[model samples]
Target chain A: MTEKLNVFAVRTLTQKEYFAPGHRACQGCAEALAVRLVAKALGRNVIIASATGCMEVVSSPIPFTAWRVPWFHVAFENAAAVASGIESGLKVLMRKGRLPRKKIVTIALAGDGGTADIGLQALSGALERGHDFIYICTDNEAYMNTGIQRSSSTPFGASTTTSPAGKVKMGQITWKKNMPAIAAAHNIPYVATACPSYPIDLVEKVKKAASIEGPAYLHILSVCPTGWRSAPELSIKLGRLAVETGIFPLYEVEHGKYHLSIDFPRLRPIKEYIRLQGRFRHLTEEMIGQIEERVRKEYAELKEKAAKGVAR
Target chain B: MGKRVGMEVSIAAAEAVKQANVDVISAYPITPQTHVVEHLSELVANGELDAEFFCVESEHSALSVCVGSEATGARSFTCTSSQGLALMSEITYIASALRLPIVMIIANRALSAPISIWNDHSDVMSIRDCGWIQFFAENGQDVYDHVFIAYRLAEDRNVLLPAIINMDGFTLSHVIEPIEFIEQEKIDRFLPPYQPVHRLHPDRPVSMGGIALPPIFTETKKAHEVALQGSMPKILETWKAFGDMTGRYYQPVETYKAEDAETIMVIMGSFGETASAAVDLMREEGRSVGLAKIRLWRPFPFEAFKQATLHAKQLVVIDRAISIGGPGGPVASEVKAALYGEPIRPVVYNFVAGLGGRDVSPSDFIKMVDKAEIEIEEGNREGYEIYGVRE
Candidate 1:
């Protein structure tokens, strides 16, 4: 049941990039990095239906765009639903010989708020309907575009504008939504959790998901330094720390089988991941111990599930 | 002209979608509208219509799917009823704002408070300003014909906006009627292939539905308004072309014996038929009563409506939906606003009738007209009256 990471190789990217530069994303936005990798992975013959959130606003401003591919931004909660339409439309055209391309890769990209909170119903519907598209959730924990409000994906005890740390109440009181598990419950063909710090893993997962015939879900832990109250330069560091500490594991569920893609032999304490972020500044030693216990319990459960290879 | 066949209204509507050769249909079933999508699904399933049929999870996703496919230059379609349309309300606005040119058929039904499952105009009124070109179909013939008209006008490069064809729930939807079914070749010649001026294609990349900030927000809205108002000519031209081919003509306003009448009744949707019958009875009695049916709801048909009511001294406006605490019903308010500054204005009487499937027969229409005349003379026509209300 143990899994090991592949040895580091020379990082080379595809020559053709669909996501161009000059996007209005922040200096060290990990979501932007993930999108760049995803665009490269899904090189050509792709259409992206994005939701109304940071990625969409940053990529497409009023008369300018950073996308070199055909892109659409619908309402906040219907990215997956919109992509379902695109997939169906393309299929019809291809079948009728109206379109020159025999196949097109359709992807929907959304932020944590657009994926886990407001947009979850549409995502669930799209997955249940088995649309031939890949939905990528760029989880930044909070609604960063709206000035750091807490989303359902915001981890327990992380301070957001809406979940600010105060004298009586701790930061966030709820656990991060388990989106991959929810997607797994739909019994889609592919479900994976990825991190931007691991470009090779993220890109590979995107490519794999694009090749999937049925619905595929990819949850990427996109680090947001501004929302997390950490140094912008620590975006990549935080992404790596998140996966390394078992707070966010990199794994895939294909059909009904679970396989760990990036398994840590030994996990660091929860503080190793939270200490660099000011959002966790109010955590006492007792609180940190509690968080550690919770993380260990959840990691142990995920590990057991991966080992048992249970569909459910 | 094509052969006439006896078919259920819903099936005929589905046949129109088939003849249009739409590329995609995404729908979630609601009563009255279900038969339309159910038949469409069969057509797609049997390869009769080469289209993608998506049984979407909700009406929200149904219209959202249409927007997605329409942006890809596909002629997309979807149908819904009262609560279903309410569920799809948000995306309905986006479809028009994005200029997707989708054709949607709304089997008009009563909105829920008591949860009635019959016909009314509440569903259509709920989306009155969603920016889509809207039409009311009075019978099975209009439902079948308006489908083609909806597509033609909506897809015109000058129009490039979504359109809605509304038929009364269960009344026009479930009733079986003999309709002149047009051939596929004729439909092809009329509709042609939908060639979007701009669409989602990798060869020519375009960004759709971008955010409009403070500087350009009002300007964007202005552009949408101008586009809709500008679509009037194209709507007329498309109807004219269809009429030339089939001898079945349509206009923004159609009058029934209103040419030389002193009193007129204004109604939309299927109730127009009942009002026409009532007008015939009144005319036989040597009374100067007539009916003016409003087919086009958007673009207002200002000149046409004004011309239709200008000669009449008393005009009765029937509305099926209330604006709820506003002055009178939605239709009556619009009519009063339309006639406010005119030099020759009629004494308008607002009447709310046939709500939530309460049948307003021809006799009831006659009574309604009689009551409006009394109210006008008594100067009690300042507000609206709920026709047939016990109190």
Candidate 2:
């Protein structure tokens, strides 16, 4: 099934603007694409906590702001904590004063490195603390800003600067840490994964997450052209390939059950997804088979769980 | 007029919050601090204190609940120590930044690693720049007196900053001491019910925390700075009013025998009592030594600090914390800077002591003063130095 993105499908943005063009993001960055879509759904009167990462630094250049809404930039791992603070602060201010009483919502934005790595403990603490905030992770896999380094979210068999795919070593031997699964394990209200290519789905998930009280996690598969060694235009194409291969499934964990949101009629070969990105250029046929087998095993387990649906 | 009853300091603090007539008490129990909140909860349960008692799941929630209650125009409080304060720190900073006027009792304890439940300034020190008006009480009764004043200090329309009453964990919190309870009627006469300058009512609207751009951010910070600076005189006035009613005088920087002293030591929080006894012991030994206790850490009392140490030939600033690679404890550094342009600034030397509640003996205070004098006379002038360490 040759599923190239159809250009005829045009998605027009409304007059709503939460995140504006002044944000500091690399050209053709998928995270930027995801932010624009997510913000459009969140609407105004929204407050954001952008954790210290490439997005925060580039968008908020000192005095100037890329966000049209009220935003805060705290340390890398405490976006959730900062948002929690603002939420609570608003409650107090509103209770004793008139400010922060309107139809305001709080959201936390973090990079994959911040969410899956350094900020995990704080995130867990905030969720346990029962803070009403939405946590969004733009998972670009590698730490692209501080020079591309391997992160827990980096996929297996991907070549990072640290995990170079060499003649002797091959590529990344470890699998990506199941962050959405971990977030769901918190028993939070909602947890879902989306791809930048599917902006409507991503925005819809964000709106759903925001509408719910308590903690919610939305993981967006943001492809990095520089890190993935793919053409800028191929970022969205690679994102689609990831979903088609069942390598990065589009699903949501609600309450305690799993529901697969997307289903391909037939699985696309792993070589097609691998061949498009330079990170997977060094995979040998044997390596490819091993990856394929692992992906199949993971998919089987996910399907079994999804089939079970809310089992204790 | 008074009765000497052996009362635990935590109970003393709990009684003080009771006297302050706090409308809501929301807190999670932690070491050394549990007793205070437990007492408050018991008071609430028994109907002795007609207030909301929230047993929050975590310290962060505890503070958040207090913030919520305070915004709703209720006099709110919470108690915690060590990791609890660290957990509340993110919101702790926000509470002050938004000027919630919420008061908290922090039974100060050491931070984790070895995971000590013991007394230390580490946890309180970690949140030094959190914007809360911090105070250190030297004893159980001081804990009682300070809490009454703390509510007044924090709730002042000009101040509008959250206040933290820092007392030693277990050391003072669990220890029993004689405390003369201020009658509830008397407290009522002293503290008016919290009438906030603003409220979260639909009838009126105001922005508490909004998007602050560099151009507009300056105004937000300027407003905060003005409030902090403005709170100084209001705090003094309120303390004076409380002093007139209760016959207890309060100073941002309290002086103990610094008039004709050749040497002086600056200390803060509950450790001031131990330091005071040391100063008395040193003076008995024919040493011209004095002590300065900083009750209000936020306002810094720069002018008062400068004036109190103006006559002293040498100054020993004791820091109960370590700044690691930077300028030692945050206290001594600020003190040194506060005196930088003083016409008669004393020879300021830093001394780090009583960390993790390591005993701060009177002899150590004497030794610190003598060493500072030597550094002063020798003219090997430096901005700051430390005390009570292994040679």
Candidate 3:
């Protein structure tokens, strides 16, 4: 699927945007862009169950909705459970001859807090139940929808409202949860990590997820300029820097086989990514060195996993 | 007429759901509520009922699954009790707000503190204001019958809201009684396949459960209130239709020997039968006593309740659940509010009895009336009494 597309392959992607314009997202909100690319990949034959978060609040404000496809937003933590229901409902209806037996992908959308924090149990339940669905976790590190509070997905040393860098304490005290590893541990068919900055890679991954048989999980690192306290124009660049710095790697795990989406000959320095974001402004050189050591170790581990390329 | 079989109330309720041809059944097992979902799974497993039945991880997910399936245009059903209801109470409100028309059976039990899993109204009373159409069942038959009624009424175009059928936990749900099942062909004609007002479909796209801002929040609430209150006529119509088919009539506020009576006992749930027996025994003694059993709990049948109890000189309201400190009992408060400021209203007396499966027998009902009459004579009617208390 990747071989057919050229370097500037985003132009070859379908122009029909299932996620319409006129949404209420802030400028340079890459979460909204990630949603658009996901919508574009899945196209019209899909039903979306979105959790109550930034994208849901922005796109669906009562009488006006930016979703051109069938969409539902039930609550904050049950997007995966709702998607399970939708998948089962469509199957039973089709089997009972009440609905036409055509393929309609069921997709669940949620933000970082909604997925890694509140929605984790429900997502695990749905995946274990083996529902035919795609779960896209649009992670912006913090709970950006609700005033940038710290979430389980929030990285260490990143200042949030709840985990402020005060006189005694610095930023978030905990490491970001490895949601993709947890998802892959469920033995689901497909698990991937993508960013909106690489539109073609993200689109290909989404398409691949939609094609899979059972549960597929995509952990998208959606850059939130408002929450990160970064310049709006740096949203796309920050996403790229995140990938280049080996902070947020681009990879996929298919049937337990590890594959790196983009491999770097030499990773960029972590300072390039941290310096661009105000959330990490308080971090000293020593703190940066500590973060750099952890990132390097984790990136090496990921490279080793890819090198093995063995299905568990 | 269908066959009359002796079956446990929970099993019969599951049979009723099967007859309704529900497309989905998602529920988590709680005590007393377990039998209903267990039977449903068995039916689905045996191919007797072609429905999607699964036990979700938690009661919250159980109702969430129902909300999802129902919103996708599938007729959905679920059952729970006590803590399960409390766990899923959040989604119950969302389900009604979304107008999904899912049907649920609540095997009513006492809420925690001591964590007693027994018959009481505490579970149902906790969610009294959840915006779903609620009713109580007196026995196994009523529990079985209300399954069809709830689905029919809930799925109606004019009343696209969820409905709850509450039956006492062990007293009703676990007891075996002879239930006359309605014929499938008759149920087919009475309750047709659900046609959702709006659904998740690829061919015709629509978004549901959107965020309502301050600008239109009040209007949405008003519309929901109007829709719930407006469902009265359809509730009666559906009951009348079911009665016409089954030869068993039902009403929101059913009365027994209340005409020309000076004292009437107002009650709800399975204990209504015992209260009726007490009324019969009291009538044999030539006392002016009667019973008014309230079946429909939500959109309270104020007119019928008023008509039944207003003519009486004294009214005794039996509540199985207490309202903590504010009011003695929640039902008594509602009853008082319903008859407040009326020109010719009865003096209301409230008794909170049968807490946590302590049986309220026919004699207990008689004792309540006896105590109420004495208390009324002594002019001590400002608050309520917890009847049969040791203190």
Which stretches of candidate 3 lie above 4 Å from their native place? Answer: A1-8
- lDDT, candidate 3, residue B381? 69
Clashing pairs in 1: none
Q: On lDDT, who's better, 2 or 3?
A: 3
Q: What interface RMSD does each of the candidate structures achieve?
A: 1.0, 6.8, 0.7
Q: Give the clashing pairs for model 3.
A: none
lDDT of 1 by residue, B131-241 (tens): 999999889999999988999889888889999998999889999999998888888899887889988877788888887778888988899999999999998998899
**Maximum-TM-score candidate:** 3
Whole-model alpha-carbon lDDT for candidate 2: 0.78
lDDT tens per residue, model 1, A36-110? 989987776789999999998888878888899899998999999999999888787777777776667889999
- After aligning candidate 3 to the native by TM-score, how far in Å is the CA of A292 from where it should be? 1.1
Q: Candidate 2: which docking quality band?
A: incorrect
Better TM-score candidate (1, 3): 3
CA lDDT, candidate 3, residue B333 = 94
Model 1 chain B poorest ten-residue lDDT run:
B375-384
Candidate 2 lDDT, B287-309, residue by residue in tens: 89888888888867898888788
The DockQ figures for the candidates are 0.75, 0.07, 0.81
lDDT of each: 0.89, 0.78, 0.92
TM-score order of candidates, top first: 3, 1, 2
